[model samples]
Target: MPASPREEDVLTARELYRFYRAGEEETLALRGVSLRVRRGETVAVVGPSGSGKSTLLGCLAGLDEPSGGEVRVDGVRISHRPETERARLRALHIGVLLQTRNLLPHLSVRDNVRLPQRAAGRKPVTSARELLAQVGLGERMDALPRQLSGGELARAGLAVSLANSPAVLLADEPTGELDGETERMVLAMLRDRAAQGCAVLIVTHSAEVVRSADRVIALEDGRTTAATAPAGGAVPAEVSDATG
Candidate 1:
């Protein structure tokens, strides 16, 4: 099937700041970070361990509230919405693949992929099968998480994330645990998602992942300071000061 037309701005964060307080100390995780992502585009967020990459993704996915500024997803102000409303919006519009696999140990691969649909109260799309096929796991639909290799489990996680046909896909270290070949396969799947009109945002420390992105944004000490456009669509260099 042909992909939808690219939307101008599928996700945006303006003057975003996040802070956490521990007794007498207050720590700032994200400092005045602002970004925009268009539909059918892949953007990579690279930073060190404390640079706030995950915090930014959390805010963008409406999984956490920002201390200040705003996050808009599909033109809806996610930062201002009530928790229940924001969660509903996320269920309807966003898919996230964290660094850790979140599949249920007791569920088969196919059932795990279908979990998101059940949560969202939405019907599953036939594309779920195609997604599994794309990830090279078409034959493992009946396997349990423990029955699959690390790579196969990752592929299943990817397929599950797509169950909602989400407008925005936020992935954190989607290939962190894979071998070189498996990483390539996972990156290919992510690129295809962007090509299919989903705004793809990935947080990673991998040079390969950075290179695959359409644009690369670097974070330093919780601040965004550098961005590089793709060079003839080639993978770019590792540009962030953050390690993970």
Candidate 2:
């Protein structure tokens, strides 16, 4: 049986709504969307383009405020707070990996991973070197973002995202640009993090990502349509064990 929400849920959103207005036009990007990601689970959010996937991720991560509703991380309210407060909460509990990549071109891989630790003003649960090593980039820690190849850059970005040992990891189209093999590798690493007790949520259209997730949530026309197990179920044991 699944764990109780009160015991294992690390990320929660209820009745989320997002609206944008310009002059006489009003657009609703998200309409009363809600979901939960439990500790040590991998959830994939899948939907067609313009179906509010990005908006949902933004609100969940506290990067964008919902027009009406609430978001909580580790049982603390994150939405409706002032930007500074929201940022503080995000730094402490949320790690976001965007499709465009989350690294700074000018910073070395190690420094990029350390940035969130500095912002949180707390000791990292894992050191920068350890994170890079876990992602198979130990020798590339001193390399700049621009110097790394595609797969290396992706893993480096992931290391940065995991630096603070966030309770929830929100990834937007995390493997959109990777080749099939690399995508599998990255998904394996993400699952490894989940195994270590971090709730991981990925927004993507990738079939591989959906297959790797423990559960799949589908969105359509700005609201949740259904929640189901992946067509192929969870990642295979072989894939899950390739995190190194």
Candidate 3:
């Protein structure tokens, strides 16, 4: 049976498993991992390389399917669905930030952000331009992915992920490539979003991210454990400019 998420839970995953078959050999990537992220909360998943953090994020975002169990966003099942259905659900309720950065090489930053809004097939509650501005990318809205700096790319990707004002945000190594200052700036933006009631779940290796989270889940050998109890307190400060 599917685990029943609480009314406040915006993102939930239960008993997740993933298997990869390479000819005669099979590899298990996840082993019955389960988690919950409630509205206005931030949770961080931390683990070493090959520990299934990316796999978990992929499953949560509906970009990949679980071999067992399910994922739900806003109370709707996203696992075991058709690709089109998963895509629609993801666009409607989930914002995902990929490690490589979610941008098309040829598209301008504006269009990259616009793509998710178009995919949702609804008039955007917040315009793409406004999102870019919020990330301090207003001046680079017309720039291509290759034209921006590392910090700019991160901010642009964030804008694209937030295009639909989703109920949940799933980020994989969101600030993995930035300097300390730039990473802080990006994290503050993520904190700001969580403050506005988006359930934020980050798969990360950064101690700073883990420190900023309201709770931490540690994954090892495809299993999960509560690494720390919830440290609820005031939200972080507003995001500052990071044009580098």
User: lDDT scores for all predictions?
Assistant: 0.82, 0.86, 0.86
lDDT of each residue in 70-164, candidate 3, tens digit only: 99888899999999999999999999987685999999999999999999999999998899999998899999999999889989989988999
lDDT of 2 by residue, 1-244 (tens): 2223466788988888999999999989999888899999999887777889999999999989999989989999999999999998999999998767599999999999988889999888799999999999999999998899999988998888888999999999888888878888889989998999999999887777878788888888889887888767653222222221
State candidate 3's TM-score.
0.92
The TM-score that candidate 2 achieves is: 0.92
lDDT tens per residue, model 1, 1-244: 0123225889888888999999999999999998888899899998767889989998998889999988887977889679988887887888998767669989988888777777787675655567677677899888889999888888888888787888899998887778888888888988888999999999998877887888888888779978777645544344432223
Q: How many clashing residue pairs appear in each of the predictions shown?
A: 5, 0, 0
Q: Distance from true position, residue 85, model 1, in Å?
A: 2.1
Position 146, candidate 3: lDDT: 98
> Pairing residues by index, what is the TM-score of model 1?
0.89
Candidate 1 least-lDDT 10 residues: 235-244
Q: Given candidate 1, what's the lDDT at residue 165?
A: 85
Each prediction's TM-score versus the true structure: 0.89, 0.92, 0.92
Q: By the lDDT metric, which is better: model 1 or model 2?
A: 2
lDDT value, residue 76 of candidate 1: 79
